[model samples]
Target: MRFSRGAAMVALALMCLPGLSMAADIDGGSLSWAWGIPFAGILLSIALMPLLTPSFWHHHFGKVAAAWTLAFFLPFAAVFGPAVAGSSLVHAMLAEYIPFIILLVALYTVAGGIFIRGNLHGSPAVNVAILAIGTALASFMGTTGASMLMIRPLIRANDNRAHKAHVVVFFIFLVSNAGGSLTPLGDPPLFLGFLKGVDFFWTVRHIFPETLFLVGSLLGIFYLLDRWYYAKEGVLPVDPTPDTRGIGFDGAVNFWLLAAVVGLVLFSGFWKTPLGITIFGTEVGLPGLVRDAGLVAVTFISLRLTPASVHTDNQFSWGPMQEVAKLFAGIFLTIIPVIAMLKAGAAGPFGAIVSAVTRPDGEPDPAMYFWATGALSSFLDNAPTYLVFFNTAGGDPATLMTTLAPTLAAISAGAVFMGANSYIGNAPNMMVKAVAEERGVAMPSFFGYMAWSGAVLIPLFVIMTFIWFR
Candidate 1:
């Protein structure tokens, strides 16, 4: 569904509200911890509902999200008055959710249009090559995009194999999660950091080593595992969907659009201007406006220019995007009070969280931040989880990128990397599983996937904590 125009109209309507501009700020220290319950409720809904009641969640996920949003807002208005609630909603929408969703839609739409044609034999070497390529592309096109683009071809390549579930599992590990650690464009958590005024290159520059360690280790492990499987199971006598043509790309025009997407994101980060407008309590910068508008143009342009056949081959639909949009809309709203409480620091209700991540010298502990952010991100939405720790670490981007750089790196690396710890850790983890299952891969169950991650990924994270986060 189209969101840009609707988002703009909502922003415009909110801007016109009479008293919202003068609303007082949320008093996080004064508000009890109960304000965070709606946020917890929504996150729990996201984590459990799908696994426990797939059919009901599939049909009514949006309604569930909306219910949580109201669960927060109605009580919030009753307690704090409508003006405060209105301004909070406006700020969350204009400053955070709208910009976030726009970039995702642009990437999703453009990337969906470009399909990789032809197939290769799923030899261990060939499988490693595909995973390597996907890992590299994930930093640019996003994990979701790279996962979608590469999964089908990889599946086709391995369809002739007797035992191949491990292949998809490693695919989730390398392509869908760890590969996206290096850039804001790569994953939702890093993007939220960028939106919070972290530089576009901050993550890549800071966490490249961690990303290399994780991705390289996972790839190496997968290669050895795949080789053993190939030796044991051997290939089917007849290849399913045998290679008919040399591997090449279709809908190449989207490459230009993808480049445009990158350019827009970078331009917004680099271009600073005093020019901006105030909508309710939020400041909408001119460069941000231009960047978001450019993304929307690129999205529709890809849809228009790419051949319909290309989209058909890709099995592209807006269902996933719609689901992300609705769920995150609730998340961004419910997270407002939570962020405020976090910003309150050691004196706030969440003082224990601060104490947990802080050293005796009053310095933030990188190791604690790493595991704390990681442990929560394993089950909650990584994007908001990142935001939670971000504000917890004082919510000052300048300080975060400088003296506290290691702590920032820890948080970033944790949210992105530990997302592979569970199927629901990142959105793309489940998407990859669903696609693989549809293609006849006997994918692991939810707990089964966790078993894989616990075995493979947890050990690596432990080693990383000692090597880097310490």
Candidate 2:
């Protein structure tokens, strides 16, 4: 009778539960706000140390990131036993960082292989046309893909010009940042949002007008500036690369590979398979595992298929991608507690932050969401910054898509658009900057770049605030 009663109790408990264990989740309320200091320190190191001591930071950057990781982890492990820390580490690696790096590597390798041969003269019309093309491609191939593909051609176009720096700056504006505003494929933050259940076309539907306005305004400004410089410098009597064989691409096959990348991402988003495995309390969905594996295969296929000559011509190297990987490794790790606190909402230490962006009447304020998300995204990694605010705005994709649509739009726009505010604002910004500087463009210093963004981009964002956010 006792055995029968025990079996019945077990059956009752089983009936009360879902079919499987819920995915591992962090308890933000259990965290201290002080846990964020190392994350902030890593961020500050990323922002300042490079500007302050370029060579030292460049060589020691990996070690610097490691130090910050230890700073966060040692204390974190001490406070919360190794099991909790291990779960957190496993969750960050499997669920977030690995996929993030895989996608970047696949895009970079694929895009790097595709080279546009033949020299392009950086005429105003030609430059504007390229910018327009890149902006359109960005929403599909990703800002990094579009940027890596285009930045070389762009730099080559202006190589003969006396006034070359501004061209690179505008390239950063449109190709590296604003162009990516229309879809999840265009930007990392949006992609992360998509993985979290935001629909594929949600961004294109909501943020299209804002992207058009900003991108259009930037193009117009660049054209006028380029035209004035063209007139001032006039044409050179002897063209540097005077070969008249119009533009032709070197690696045509990679375009299909790029398309496959897009398909895989969309497949993961749409295909729901009940099959998946739990790894360290994290659910590894079947589609995601397949997508990531497919991407790895695509990367190898591109590397093997494309001629080495194309890479040489493109001046392709792995340095920028390496830098992003090392730096973001530390970023993704340190920001764990910060993201946890944010997810805790009003009950957590960061409740005041959530309270700041909400109206007294309990409605979400779009303008505040825009500024708060944008401001942090400008300094922190935009992808995770987007996640933080996305949670703060109520982490429900269906609700965010419909009734709270404006809030979602604000978060998306802020994360994608304001990434140009600083070099460290987005991964591609630093890559573009490093590439431009190496190509002999006298890039603006950190604060110096801010002056340019403040002068050109800030007013436009303000106008956008009034037009869209209001």
Candidate 3:
């Protein structure tokens, strides 16, 4: 019943999506070598997918999914080589998106784990509230913050229970990912968009439907799954020797410190502006000491303000977040050469997508940018992926929009929204998996996560595509 209702709501929401107020048709571009090179690159990546695999490729769905994405984009990028290698495009991407992704990954690692309160059996309503509030909190503090803050409380809530992993999994799907879509402050990609001229309120308002539908439906499915596990596995009662201590100040709320870090992040996002400042006679720029300094300050405050006993009580260690940092740092670095090449040809490759679609005025399709950008985001770091598309959309001289604003919104909506298509699409997916593992929830392998998304997320996106983007 919950699924049906949520799906119905999603379908209805689609029926009323904002239609284009004015139509401007722009058409095909003449071919160039720049376009061809990148298109070939995409194809070659796809062809080499087999070589990138491990012996356990079949079992490791995540690797398989990555290979599949490489396959699709590599071929596509090859055919659109001109679009893949423009220096201007590459520069913009680096200046805009890269630092943003780096900041988010760093923040997640520093915030450590979130701790949840209350047991699972206290009240069904309370459980929902925790999930809802916790997820919302995650978008702001970084998903790791919310995850770290709530996971233990949730575990403790279900401490005497056997069917708890299911709760954590749904929590991953909802609070960790979907819930953060509304604010750039909420998710790295959206936040990048915010830095790039996307109105903060715009993403929040427009994305509400997407977030609500996906989360509500997933939660509904989770409830049913939870019931099945509950029936089969009895609750593990609270430990007789459970540690019961009074709740201390939970005083870690050093608002000014966190705000300072966020302010620095925002300034970094607009690195070209005077808003960029120097502290102690030193300039603080994107990916520079100033930004790192802010993060350092917040980390110190969060650590110092948190009760020493809380760390002991939570069994907290920096290992899991550290691992995420190390792994993603490698990923971000290795992919630089690849992303650089693709970015160089951003325009020409995207032009190829435009050529494929016929416009009503025989004008090239305005939407080619949306699809190309969206398609790329599902594979690359969504923040940079978004900037690539946003720049492309804004760069087109023929685009009818009088200002960059609408195009920015469309680009942002596509990049931030579509990024959820696969596990590797965003940083949070990796973080969630790591946190889940720490909590002892055996999450689905990469492909397994996709299977779940395929079952739930994909259809919802399809509806969104037709209703919002199409």
Segments of candidate 2 deviating more than 4 angstroms: 1-25, 231-242
Give me the displacement of residue 379 in model 3, in angstroms: 3.0
Tens-digit lDDT track for model 2 on 165-197? Answer: 788888889999999988888898998899889
Off by over 4 Å in 1: 1-18, 161-165, 188-202, 228-242, 379-402, 430-448
Q: How much is 336 displaced in model 1, in angstroms?
A: 2.5
Q: Model 3: what TM-score? A: 0.67
RMSD of 2: 8.5
Point to the candidate with the largest TM-score.
2
Which pairs of residues collide in model 2? none
| Stretches of model 3 off by over 4 angstroms after superposition | 1-106, 113-126, 237-256, 266-289, 344-375, 395-410
lDDT of 1 by residue, 120-216 (tens): 8999999999999999999988898788778878898899999989999999999999888888888988987887899888999999988888888
- Which 10 successive residues of model 3 have the least lDDT summed? 19-28
Query: Which prediction has more favorable TM-score, 1 or 3?
Result: 1
Cα lDDT, model 2, residue 142: 90
RMSD for each of the candidates: 3.2, 8.5, 12.6
